[model samples]
Target: MRTDSPRLSRPATFVRAFAIACALFFLFPRHAHSQIHPTVSFEVASIRPVAGGESGGEGGTRSQIETTADGLTMRNIDLSEMIEWAYKLQHYQLSGPNSLAGSRYDLRAKSGDHVAESTLRLMLQDLLATRFKLQLHREQKKTSVYELVIAKGGPRLPKDKSATIPPSYPKETFPRVVDGGFVFQNVSLGDFAQQLTEIRTIDLPVIDRTGIPGVYDITLKSAASALLDPSGPSILTLIQEQLGLKLVSAQDLIEVVVVDRFEPPSAN
Candidate 1:
């Protein structure tokens, strides 16, 4: 049997082993074996557009004035008309802890887009940390409440998919002073001031602006430039323009006093 059988050589066995190894390499390469893959991710949220600020809008209050000389007098007066001009001052500084907080952003791949969201976010985060001294945090509080979800529940968008976006206002129309008031058009600052002064100084048959002197309402009622910080402008005008804040009549209320006892007239 030994003389009849043909035996396999070491070189042949070596060659066979090499061929098997090559076949395995072709079927499952190093990359596949290690589970390497290109994955898509998403950001937690998106940046919304800026909006908000003042709108020099409408509405006012009414006051009754009884003329000493005449029996009765009735007139509808615009409060803003009483003022000549107004000035405002404000203070803004990035000093608080949250003011310099850091944010995290995840990266995502668009169907047709090449750039990744994560890449952009990382770059922005770095810039904020190094240049702006932004702080990074991760206890849920630092993150935005909203979530960034995909449109079609996939990494890529469909052929003609659309996304619904929300509106944003950087500065919102807020009432600087909580009062009912309106804006007077076509009036110069100096002229208005002079008129106000005249009404106060002359005291010529004007409404009694005593005790609670009539507070005037004035507003800028428009968007402000970046250069326009809080304090330089007149408080009156600045309030209108910056906050849409108007002057409203203060609520009339009487206070009650609790006295233990009223001692009658002491010994005369």
Candidate 2:
């Protein structure tokens, strides 16, 4: 005699299907479907408050920022200045608490290996977020800015023959200050405009509108004091006469970083 097998119930069939699905899931590699990407950060970092809180003279409290392929070092720098450097922004591009500049700190950060300046900036950003508990956002606003353009006589800039097509980053030598003025070697117009923004005399955002390409060697003979001396020629006049460049005052919509929150760095 033949016998019939027992039929499975609905609940038993559902449990059997669920068991098979779990078994298939575990059979696959755990990370096959998903990948985790971690934020870029420095391998080692140290931040310490400076004593006396004195200015570095001429350049304000920020003494200097030194960066290499492997790391970065900022001496006698304030949070505001660090923010400016880390974000590649001008002073006008940042809106934050005046207290950000009140305190000074020396920061040294190292990476596991050699990296680009762009990567170093990201590491600095990460450090700020983690150490200072910093929070910020960007917004557009109409502001005063100076546009660097070719003057009536045209640009007197001499193209640097030795300069490469794409200039290297973190140039070894920046514009140097002489007794009377400044000198730029193998610098682009955009870079020149950026340097102008740091002048206490200019004291305004500078935009490169010359539309000129290639690097140049430039020298401005007018003293920084000329910008303030009523009897002396203004920077506008000097620039036109010496560099064949003009700074036109204009209003523009610019993106500015607004600091929402920042706290003293946590213990090292």
Which portions of model 2 miss their true places by more than 4 Å?
1-38, 53-62, 158-177, 183-188, 200-203, 213-218
Candidate 1: worst 10 consecutive residues by lDDT? 82-91
Best-matching candidate per lDDT: 2
- Per residue, candidate 1 scores C-alpha lDDT tens digits across 1-268 of 3566677799998999999999999998778834564332222212211113111121212211112121111122211110100011010111233211122111111222334333333433333233334342221112111111222323221121112211210111122222223232222232223222232222221112222211233333331321144445443344334433322233222221111222111221
TM-score of model 1 (CA atoms):
0.18
Worst 10 residues of 2 by lDDT: 165-174
Q: List per-prediction Cα lDDT, in the order shown.
A: 0.26, 0.79
lDDT of 2 by residue, 81-183 (tens): 7898889886678899899988888788899798888888889999999999999999999988999999996878766554564423333123576666777
Count residue pairs with overlapping backbones in model 1.
Answer: 32
Task: Give the TM-score of each candidate.
Answer: 0.18, 0.73
